[model samples]
Target: MNQDEDAAPVEMLASLCEARGWQYEFVGDDELTTEIQGSWATYQLRAVWRSEDHVLQLICLPDIRVPDDKKAQMYEVLALVNEQLWLGHFDVWSNGMVLLYRHAMMLGDDGLLSVAQAQSAIETAVEECDRFYPAFQFILWGDKSPADALASALVDAAGEA
Candidate 1:
């Protein structure tokens, strides 16, 4: 492996974060954490590079809460939401109050996570969270059904006036 590929993935992630001027810190030996500010919300981004498993996991927390009464419908809404996602899926914590987006990929023989891959993972996560944040809000506050919430979220306005 070349020097870049040979470098520990976590170090590379730290480099990437630094180059991008993202505020992040080493949460653990293998984890880097940051926050992504998107149009809809600020998301917590965590990158965990598992050397033993050759896996890189990216998690984005949208920082929304699902109350007990809303959890069931929120899950249903998430089902519909997940179906439309091209990468990663939204999940709730065991406490049923926190919603996070997670996507993981295996490193190839070189065990490298390229900057492009990292960027795409982050962009996808933030975009999806921004796109679907309202749907989650709809279910949480609008009293909309899963289908209705999804529909409300996905509908587009056509006007240039």
Candidate 2:
């Protein structure tokens, strides 16, 4: 196939998800939603194929609700985590409760996103979301500083091994 040829269609992405044993539903012609089970919580992942813009977007929403008082701390921790991430970044809703991790692929320049690329994007979102979830919990419930929460979250990973 020509390198500039359009990548696989949305249907192919759905098939890939199914083959991987993921439960998903099509939200629209260009969007698919799947639920991923994480160590701490179940995450809702949504993939959108923007054919016009030639981008594939992946977003993961963890089962977390940041309290009003913790919004600032949550943003601080998110900033720290975002800095460490190679792809995707954490974002908070204006309501200060909803948190989501988002990543995008420019299909126009990169060509169609292969199955591996799609899977990698999904995995990366879930992995990063799982890693930083506890930090948000700490900030919202434990009242820990952003730095402290992040440190504790990272240290906790070491203990998991």
Residue-pair clashes per prediction, in order, are: 0, 1
lDDT tens per residue, model 2, 1-161 = 33333456566567767777988899988888989888889999888888878888888999677777777888899999888889989998776468999988887554467666666787888889888888888898888999999999989977886
Judge candidate 1 at residue 53 and give its lDDT.
87
lDDT of 1 by residue, 1-161 (tens): 33244356677767767777888989889898998788778899898987888998988998998889998999999999999988889999887579999999888867777766766778898888888888999999899999998888877311211
lDDT score, candidate 2, position 136: 84
Model 1: CA > 4 A from native: 1-7, 156-161
What overall lDDT, based on C-alpha atoms, would model 2 receive against the true structure? 0.81
Model 2 residue 86 CA deviation (Å) reads 0.9
- Deviating ranges (above 4 Å) for candidate 2: 1-9, 109-111
